[model samples]
Target: MTQALPPLLDDDQAAFISGGVSISAAACRSGGLPSMARATGCRIAADRRSITILLSATASAGLIDDVRRNGAIAVVFSLPADHRTLQFKGGDARVVPLEPGDEALAERYVDAFAGGLEPLGYPTQVIRCVLACRPDDLTAISFTPSAAFLQTPGPDAGNALRSGA
Candidate 1:
């Protein structure tokens, strides 16, 4: 019999995902082309099994279309200073309405992301521009990670991730 995989994200991984990091998403378009977009914020479900990403409906239109057509998605979160990265893959992504407080969540995310890059000499305005989104145009994409991978640049990069590790 095969060993069962970890059912949810461990505490450490959850913390990492909650920290100030740059979020981006990718979806496979029709005929295998790829659509990519920069995400403005992220939220993990209470169960730690699902993640919801906030994105600009206009900025991420192509990616949203791809996810609608095919539910495959891959999201990457990376810290600008250290380049620490993690990738989560799912085959059942879906676009959904934003929750009541999600607008504020997106605001905080933009602030934290800009602050994270400030020390590295990125102009605050530029950083904010990269993640700007109007509240009315914001959308959420939710997915349960079927697989996780360590995407940091190192010998261990690409290794499968396990909870509690």
Candidate 2:
């Protein structure tokens, strides 16, 4: 018999739901994107009132590049609750690249996520802005969320915002 997974903490509650799978290590491939139907699980933690994401990957170099160019990335995983899948929409954040054996790298991720960040045992090549996008574009499956979370406005918000009500 398989051991039961623990209940999802509040941090894990806000995940990207694609079809029914949760985006986790098992769902993501080494050098490719996860299926849209697969749920990508990630922790969106707050630090000093700023939100950051915690991603686990065998190799994130390609993934980081994908996020930088596309402004978004998809993570797939299976949820333990009902054995269904889900995906979490990760919005773009700052990317910080590091060299191998950099002890300070983990600290940066931890600082980003606020709560303690756990090491995934994978060598990180680069960190890119994590962006939020819809899951309806997944190859195997097509579904859309009722709503989407856009990137946070920067200082340019004043110039971008419209005055009409």
Question: Residue by residue across 120-160, what tens digits does model 2's lDDT show?
Answer: 33222221223122232111111111112222234432231
Lowest summed lDDT over 10 consecutive residues: which window, candidate 2?
137-146
C-alpha lDDT (0 to 100) for residue 2 of candidate 2: 10
The candidate that achieves the highest lDDT relative to the unseen native structure: 1
Q: Check candidate 1 and list the clashing pairs.
A: none
Please identify model 1 stretches exceeding 4 Å from their true place.
1-6, 163-165
Candidate 2 residue 30 C-alpha distance from true site, Å: 20
What 10-residue stretch in candidate 1 is worst by lDDT? Answer: 1-10
Clashes of each: 0, 33
Instruction: List residue ranges in candidate 2 displaced over 4 A.
Output: 1-12, 15-22, 25-41, 47-58, 90-165
lDDT of 1 by residue, 7-123 (tens): 457778788877789999999976878999999989998877788999999999999999999899999999989999999988889998889899999999998889988989989
List all candidate RMSDs to the true structure: 2.9, 17.2
- Local error of candidate 1 at residue 130 (angstroms): 1.5
